[model samples]
Target: MATIYDVARLADVSAKTVSRVLNGDGPVGARTREAVQDAMAKLGYVPSNAARTMRSNRSGLVGLITGAITGAQESARPFGLPDLLIVQGIQRVMASRDMTLMIADTGGRADRVPHLVRTFLEHRAEGLIYVAEYHQQIRLPQVPDATPLVLVNCFDDAQSPAVLPDDRQGQHALVRRLVAAGHRRIAYLTLRADMEATPLRTAGYQDALAEAGLPFDPAIVRIGYQSDEEGEMQLLWDAIDDLLRLPEPPTVLCCGNDAMAMRVYGILRSRGVRVPDDMSVAGYDNHRIIAETLYPPLTTVELPYAAMGMKAADRLMSLIAGQGREEPAPTLVTGPVLWRDSVVERRAATLQSISL
Candidate 1:
């Protein structure tokens, strides 16, 4: 393998000049920098990261921990894959700074985190990011005071710096748009009642209805599923039947995610209900696989998984640079609602409640 000395000789410069160009530490003439790069490319020369780290007295390594599996799972959730997407986002940002990213998948085991953390610290990771499969709460073992640690899609009572999706805001925006489009009697088919996003999204739905002077009809709200089990599809179908049976059926059905929305599409088609012509639909988490596949593509909100990952890395880097806030409040990233062919403008009279 070609060394820095060989590159310097080919470029007609000193090894220190090659180092300067590689590390971007000190300025070299633009011509000299170009020549060095060309020479290195010609020789397929790769810089030694270990040598660079040792010289700088910093690891230049960031550690990421997640509960997501590397392969297909028997119990994977529908819609977005926050863990994998977040890691990809983090890696993208770190690569721009010439930092190495080390990832550890715990295989859905929380008990493995502490061991992973210790191993990362042993390798002198400059920072750490802990990501969860979804937005939830968690507790972790004590980390060294000096190490910069950030949480993504999860939080603890300790109020450590965290980055999360603004689910409530995203839902609120979606609902508000629907309301503005003259949709009054909107049905909400929710996800698992126990998940943190469930209540937050419900609140957003209620907020939009209240703002639009629409009555909050409990009958139109249905808990579609408690988990991503195949058995839950039956419950969703039952909820749809219940909603359609109402005296004044909803003009639109807002689903928890695109996967659920796709299921709704199949059920509605089976009943001869043309989407946007007879009933409209909207969903969250713009999982392209589900959202874009429906006859008329599903309108939904982006989950902002990658955005949260990038933001978490920014915060981690801030802490590493000794610029952390006095009180590190949770940072929220909101995704814009994606408009598609699934929904349509409705007449005001079509949204009125029917007499019992």
Candidate 2:
């Protein structure tokens, strides 16, 4: 209940001195600062955040909206949750700046985003970040001119600033590594045909093959995954069967993600196929739980989710600081390829060209 004035009186200093010490707006003598602190501790006084925000003319709040499922709901999507990591990244940067983050989960509903954004604006949030479940495009309602908005893992038709994974580069690097390891006949089991990553990654796959002087064969690449759809086991088996049945069966199978890789592990074992022996496997999104737990740890690429979150926050903060109104260009973050036990060196004996 003790006010700043009371602390000042007790410390034998002017209220202005106390205000300076509390806000750090101006320098106070070391002795004066110590005395002020001593008095505050004795009086059990706490500075009012509301008053500080009012004086500074800032809400000290950053708004974040995500379409992520948490806790029990997380079971619905076991692939790995990058949105959760992205939120953690954003919170880390915000905390360092002495700012508070206000988060809202849409539970996979994009329709609720505009309403949520409006509510944050009403609360005087200085900046806003929108996070999607994956790298995809979205359409958002109009935002005020003064507010700075940034997108994470998604972009909009309005050209809002965005931070996204460099799927092409990541996949390119992975495929190049596979080729270096003597994987001449590599097969890619792709994700949903509609998602942005599917095609970009496919392009990367081709780029590597072209560079390696390896022929690009359409039959080796197949649509292997989809979102919110069942019957994945059938699709995966069909893809695997097609790849292995080819007279020139691939030595390596590249999967869309670690979850798929996990499924592939089971499928290959069921068929009496040995990993890194009869076949080598790789995946994207080095999701540790899925990747590391497999019999032979998975060789995969990082999704750079945390890095994307940091970049988006930095961009939003820059915009808020009056750095020129940047024409929002999508900023891309690259993922590194992780080599692990799931891949084995191809020997000359296993490199024979089989006739179909």
Candidate 3:
């Protein structure tokens, strides 16, 4: 393994000069830089990350800690696609900047956050990004006053920057579409009310109902855990049964995610109910499998995972570059809706029945 010393010997420059060139800490003559580059290429010299951190106290590495709840019995893993997309975006930006990433999964292990932050600090990470599997309020570990930090799909104190989807706007848009298709008795199946995204989406549901002059029926709103598939299925089944027994059941069911929607689809199918024709369904996060492969494709909101990741990385980089100003503010991104085959115009009889 070629080291910085090897490159220095080949380039006939002091190790400090090589370090300066690598860290961009000081200017090196163009010819000198070219010689160093040439030597690096010839020797297959890979700079020692440890030495670089020692010189500048900057790791040139970013830390991404994810707090995803994989054990939940939900329709799907909540953070899978968004986390992947965010990482892709972050990598896109980091690659251009010659930075590397160190990712850690917390698995909802909130207590380990302080230790994780310390570990990244020991590694001399220039910045940190904390990603939550779902949008929820989080209490972050106490970090160094100088270290730049950002949050993805979650928020903390006003001092840190965060980037997440605009759930309220996305849900509102989805509900409006259902109303346009003449769906009045709309039901919403959501995660626990305590979850951050749930309230935002629930607010959107109410907003659409108000706009359409439809009465808000609490009975049609159901909430459950997001931890596992069996629990999710059971909760959804119970919600569906309750909704079906209503004097006039909803013609539209809007789910918090593709996972839940898929479960609902299975329950409905098993009960001999046809999709769209019998009940229109929509969901958020637009999980690829559910959107593309389901018997009746799902209409869903596409989370701007990549964009959020890119923005979060950019913001963190800006902070690291000393370009950040004032305390960090929460950032929200909006994803476009993907229309699919899961929804249809409410039949005249269905509409009449709900009205009666």
Could you tell me every candidate's TM-score relative to the true structure?
0.84, 0.90, 0.82
Q: What's the lDDT for all of these models?
A: 0.87, 0.88, 0.82
lDDT by residue (tens digit), candidate 3, 14-61: 888888788788989999999998999999887776766676677779
| Location of the lowest summed lDDT over 10 successive residues in candidate 1 | 347-356
What is the TM-score of candidate 1?
0.84
Q: Write the per-residue lDDT of candidate 1 for residues 218-312, one digit (tens) a residue.
A: 99999886454577789888999999999999999999888788888988999999998999999998888778888798899999888888888
Q: What is the per-residue lDDT of model 2 for residues 48-128, given as tens digits with 9 covering 90 to 100?
A: 877887778788899999866443265555775457888888888988888889998886777888899999998889999
Name the candidate that leads on TM-score.
2
Worst 10 residues of 2 by lDDT: 347-356
What TM-score, to 2 decimals, does candidate 2 have? 0.90
| Global Cα lDDT for candidate 2 | 0.88
Error of 2 at 206 (Å): 1.0
Q: Cα RMSD (Å) per model?
A: 4.3, 3.0, 4.3
**Who wins the lDDT comparison?**
2
What residue pairs are clashing in model 1?
none
